[model samples]
Target: MKRYRFEDLPDIIGELLLKMNSIEKLLLENKVNNVVADDDLLTISEAAKLLKLSVATIYTKVCRNEIPANKQGKRLYFYRGELLNWIKSGRIKTITEIQLETETKFNSKNIYK
Candidate 1:
């Protein structure tokens, strides 16, 4: 590290502040982008791509009301959060999880007896 004299301190501090401001701007932009992405409205094709399913399947699911979506006139839109939640809702419990749940239920029943 180069030792800075008192004269150079002001310049060094100014440069640091400029760099910090640039970094702050970049961070804020990134956060805004992430927020927008989370709430983004996705078309049928985009939803299909995100869910790794065919567009036709997405349409069928929408028709059956199995997937969360919004219909605006002739257009169908899905929220990224809703799609992610739908995926999460369909998750199958593991055997261990089921066993633990069963055990908890049985124990609670015994306690109530």
Candidate 2:
């Protein structure tokens, strides 16, 4: 990060605040009901809507450690970006993809038959 001059600090902060307000306005206008802020830690209900799952299901996954979350006392919190990435990581491979992987494994010749 570049060091900022103390003299110019207020101007820089004001500009950042304006940009933040602009971004907030745009987000509100778009009506993005599921995920709102850039770094919002979501509640169980919010997480369920974002993931298209039920609140009970989210609780179940949290208990089973199948999903990523932070447990604070009795509360659960999830990061929106991380949850989206986790959902992406569970993608199913097609038949061709499985065949290609199998072929690659056999071609490597390092495995014991």
Candidate 2 lDDT, 1-113, residue by residue in tens = 98899999999999999999999998887776545653589999999999999999999998899999998999999998789889899999999999999999888986665
Best by lDDT: 1
Highest TM-score: which candidate? 1
RMSD of each: 4.7, 11.8
The models' CA-based lDDT, in order, is: 0.94, 0.90
Provide TM-scores for the models. Answer: 0.69, 0.61
Instruction: Please identify model 1 stretches exceeding 4 Å from their true place.
Output: 1-33
Candidate 2 Cα RMSD (Å):
11.8
- lDDT tens string, model 1, 40-112? 9999999999999999999999899999999999999999988998999999999999999999899988956
Against the true structure, candidate 1 has what lDDT?
A: 0.94
